[model samples]
Target: MDAYKKAGVDINAGYKLVDDIKNLSNNKDLGSFGGLFPLSLGAYKNPVLVSGTDGVGTKLLIAIKANLHKTIGIDLVAMCVNDVLAQGAKPLFFLDYLGVGHLDNEKAKDILAGVVEGVSQAQAKLVGGETAEMPDMYTHGHYDLAGFAVGIADQAKLLSKANPREGDVLLGLASNGLHSNGFSLVRDILFKQNTYSLNDRLAGCNRDLKDELLRPTKIYVKSVLPLVEQGTVASIAHITGGGLPENVTRILPDNLSAVFDYGSWQVPAIMKDLQKIGHLSFDDLLHTFNLGLGMVLAVHSGDADEVQSQLQAAGEIVSRVGRLTSGDKQVIIRKDQQ
Candidate 1:
């Protein structure tokens, strides 16, 4: 054993892990200095590259605490690919970075498998990734994951804040659960403050607490990409850390605001449980968590019905949650009159 191995950095094990990744992802060029992707501008007259990067957030803690590593990688890919999808791009390739205190080949393989699944779900290729073994940087049996996704879209057809206009209807896609946000608060409330265990089943929830917390984020690429291509979508918002109010406002023009008809869609029971346990206010819930809707779209009023129909046909649970109105660039959640 050399001095470097003695210091906890195993060069040979890293090389073996590279082979493991190549087998898991089937990317032969993964061990190279940089990942390679063959880009073909099939239908894009003027192709524009859209890129996004994100991490799984403190949600990793839940996975680690439960010793569940399979689905976290999906969250990693969803966090990035969904962002690019929000910009009306088709995800082309993905890359991941995993940092760990010690290299455990089995655990690493499980995590990479989820990444592979995520890429498959997004219809993107996993070109390459890096696994860093840093002693003392992270605790043993714990790792951090970050992912980068690159997508392509026609320069003229790219969705932006300017794309949304007044009278456009806002369509919200239902989220499965927490979908990888507000975990810092979730952890504080469920574990630090309350006595809930991952094994305990909360009211209205079908699965155990661990299953709810670790539910992988839903990838919107497959369902929303078709709408983007059809040009029915004016703008899309991938609700994440800032929840609906913060994320929806990002794609709203300065003179337009999003008026959401709250209670239009079913709020996942897990979210309600957390709110009650934490005594969270509506505003707090709005600012921190996704609150059920994962991705919201601003569609032209004329095409709202057709778009909703198409989303339903694609097996997406969507709601006519809001509309764009003449106001400052903000989100207004109001009770539904009808």
Candidate 2:
């Protein structure tokens, strides 16, 4: 061991991680100080590269508190890839950055495994990444994850912002419970204010709080990418920190608004339970959490049924949640079910 190893850095463990990631990504040449991806411009006639980078917010605290390191990486990957997918891009490759106070070989590998799994799930290659071991930077057993994804879309095939029009139908894709957004509030309400334990179980929830909260953010790549490629989707919204109101409004043109039937689709029991326990207003719930929908899309009225059929065939729970109406940019949630 060298002086670096004596000073809390394990050189061999770093090398072991590099080797493991290299094997996982199948980029044997990644050890060359920088990662490389070979793209044949010949494959695309005028391509636009789309890039996105995102981190799993304080939701990471739940994973750390519960000592569950496996799925945060998946959330990390989903956060990035899904954003890129919104623009109709096919993810080509992904890279990750992990920073830690001290290197624990087994734990590090366990965490990275989810990244590898996420990349695979996105049908993208994990081309490169960096794992930094800094003793003073992070506290013991503390780490942070950031992911970057690069993808390509043909210029003519992009999911442009202007595509949505009045009379278009909005499709709501089901979310797997709190998919890595507003978790700081979630922790504050459940764990801090309410004093709930990780093992605590609430009504209408089949799993413990830890299991429910740590459920990985869903990756929409495999489900929605096909629609993007086929040009069946007019626009898309990846529901994250802004929830449905903020995210859905982003893709809408100024002349249009989305009007949703509140009771058209079932809000996940966990989210409803959170609302009841926290006494969160409907506005807060719409803007702070996904409720039950993860990705909402705009499809032409005629194409809506076919798109829903295709999405369902691709194994997604699809709901025609709303429609585009002529108005200033807004989201209207009818009060019938609230």
Candidate 3:
């Protein structure tokens, strides 16, 4: 027999994946090889293409530990889409890559279904993807997923860190608790505490720990794209592996830094539990976990309240977290002081 057959990777599963995704793969319209998007020049004076690619980090280990394979696909899509959105681009299409030790049809299907769900939520087309079953690696019952997303925006319409000025306000949209980042530290906490199962519910949290952990990364595309379309936001930051302090600064101009009043928003209960139980310090908690806020938008001070109102009406928990200041590169998190 073939090497794949000898190595436990079923060649039949590869055929089945393509066959099952025929409808999805055939939705291409423009010049993408595996996936396509129609060029609609209806709205742009001069359009520019923005693309981002990202993978769900070690968070896959948690999903594998909990035997929860489906929702991680959403994380894969969200990671890439959110990054592009930070550049004021609306996601038009998404593609994925799934790699594993061996092909498991049921698990692969579950993952793809979640990816489709994420694409639908982001209002983007699910184009195509690569699924590789590499035997003798990754150990059984484990896999990794990543995704790429492409978006279009007018060259002049795209946002830049230059928009952030001395008086711009920082508005934070609450996260759904540790969404697809900081899992390495989280796993460390669990291992250090000797807790093997993620399903064990925390002391005061409303949901099982595994359920909370598996909560799909939020797709802020639809919610924030309208604001970008209206030309209201100055800059946007997607909080990923690095917590607020680091991620927020990436989108700030060289002359501006963020001065965050960390007490402005309430920290979610799960983070509180992690801090108290795991004996994590304030610095670690702020630098490692989302602490409830996911995405932050920098806008003119005059528009801050209005933008917050609009985002709130759209069902996003918007908070006035801080302000842009004239300084060198650094993010300052402090309480109001005398």
Number of the predicted model whose lDDT against the real structure is largest: 1
lDDT of 3 by residue, 38-102 (tens): 78989988898899999889888888878878888888888889888999988898988889888
Return the TM-score for each candidate structure: 0.98, 0.96, 0.93
Q: How high a TM-score does candidate 3 get?
A: 0.93
lDDT per residue (tens digit) for residues 1-338 in model 1: 69999999998998998998898888889899999988897798999999999999999999988989999999999999999999999999999999999998888888999999999999999999999999998984778999999999999899978788899999999997999999999999999999888999999899999998999999989989998998999999999998998899899888999998888988899888888999999888889989899999999999999999999998899999989999998788896553
Task: Please say which candidate is ahead in TM-score: 2 or 3.
Answer: 2
* Strongest candidate by TM-score: 1
lDDT of each: 0.92, 0.89, 0.84
lDDT string for model 2 (180-216, tens) is 9999889988988788999998899999999999999
Which runs in model 3 stand beyond 4 Å of their true positions?
1-3, 23-33, 336-338
Q: Using lDDT, rank the candidates from best to worst.
A: 1, 2, 3
lDDT of 3: 0.84
lDDT at 137, model 1: 88
Scored against the true structure, residue 203 in model 2 reaches a CA lDDT of: 98
lDDT of 2: 0.89
Please list the residue runs of candidate 1 whose C-alpha ends up more than 4 Å from where it truly belongs after superposition.
336-338
